[model samples]
Target: MRTEAIEAWTQLYAAVGLLAVICASCAALKTIVELRGGTVAFPHATWTQKFLWFPRLWLRFQLAYMSGFPCIMGIALLYAHYIGFAAFNPS
Candidate 1:
């Protein structure tokens, strides 16, 4: 019973952490796009760069090179360690 309780709580914590990381990633991507002055072209990018690939590449670079990956990995590692702990002590 206690083991089941721990397993349930671990799953719940992981789920909450996963949601938070996703939200943070979206915010990070949006901020990166905004900082790079990427805009939604309704009619035209009269004064700005009019290449769709620029923003796409920029966001991809941000996700790959910036802190997003590490943050997600760290959260994953944390949950993994928690599960490991639970696994080795199933009392």
Candidate 2:
């Protein structure tokens, strides 16, 4: 019935939320590491440099994150709707 649809929708949305969180966290972590610069024995990365590097890396990360948000949201919303429809329509 309608209840089943709601349950399915909830599960779908929850999964999407989890995925978004993981993706954002990973990107953020990578950006952080890239911003931290120091070296003696290690190879020098162009991204890992003076104060300016942090802002640049951060800006890129933000842009990338923002770019992905819409797609992620759309996917999540679609999945939720599909699940909701499927759960309620046994036939």
Candidate 3:
């Protein structure tokens, strides 16, 4: 019961971390396109335009690059470790 719950939670965390990594990749590609003077269309506007109009978007990008993906990956790793330990020492 508890082991099952832990396994489920670990899977959930891994899925979320994967999503974060994908998002980070997209953001990195957008940054590269913008740097090369190429355009990337977002929902409403181009990524370049968004960065210019919303300075916070730039900060968010930097934050994601610096910590967001790593933090999510860390959480996923922690959950996986817990699951492994629980499996080995069933108590």
Candidate 4:
């Protein structure tokens, strides 16, 4: 039982960590691109920008992604805790 829970918790945290890394790196990349005079993907985005806009939303998509990022990740953490992963338990 303990081993299984540990494995599950490990997997859950791994996924969450990967998601965080990807999000941050993508945001940084988009910022760098913009700093280099490239167009930001928002408001008047191109067709391609529409599909790859999530990370760029850090500074481009405005309030939605900015607020949604923490909200979404928090929900994921709550879900992990609700699943009986003791490692994820907040209290």
What are the candidates' C-alpha RMSDs? 6.5, 7.3, 9.4, 10.2
Residue 90, model 3: Cα distance from true site in angstroms? 15
Q: Which runs in model 3 stand beyond 4 Å of their true positions?
A: 38-91
Question: What stretches of model 4 exceed 4 Å from their correct place?
Answer: 38-68, 71-91
Q: Model 3, 1-91: lDDT tens per residue?
A: 4677666666766677676777689777767666467453334377776667556547646755766566666776676675564553434
Q: Which stretches of candidate 1 lie over 4 Å from their true place?
A: 38-91
* Worst 10-residue lDDT window, candidate 4: 59-68
RMSD of 4: 10.2
Candidate 2 lDDT, 1-91, residue by residue in tens = 4667667756876878887887788677766665574321233365455646556666768875777787788887777666655574533
Candidate 4 backbone clash number: 0
Sequence-dependent TM-score of model 3: 0.44
Of candidates 3 and 1, the better by lDDT: 3
Ranking by TM-score: 2, 4, 3, 1
lDDT of 2: 0.67
Local distance difference test, per candidate?
Answer: 0.61, 0.67, 0.64, 0.62
lDDT for predicted candidate 1 compared with the true structure: 0.61
Flag regions of model 2 displaced more than 4 Å: 38-58, 66-85, 88-91
Point out the higher-scoring one by TM-score: 2 or 4: 2
**What TM-score goes with each of the models?**
0.39, 0.51, 0.44, 0.46
The TM-score measured for candidate 1 stands at 0.39
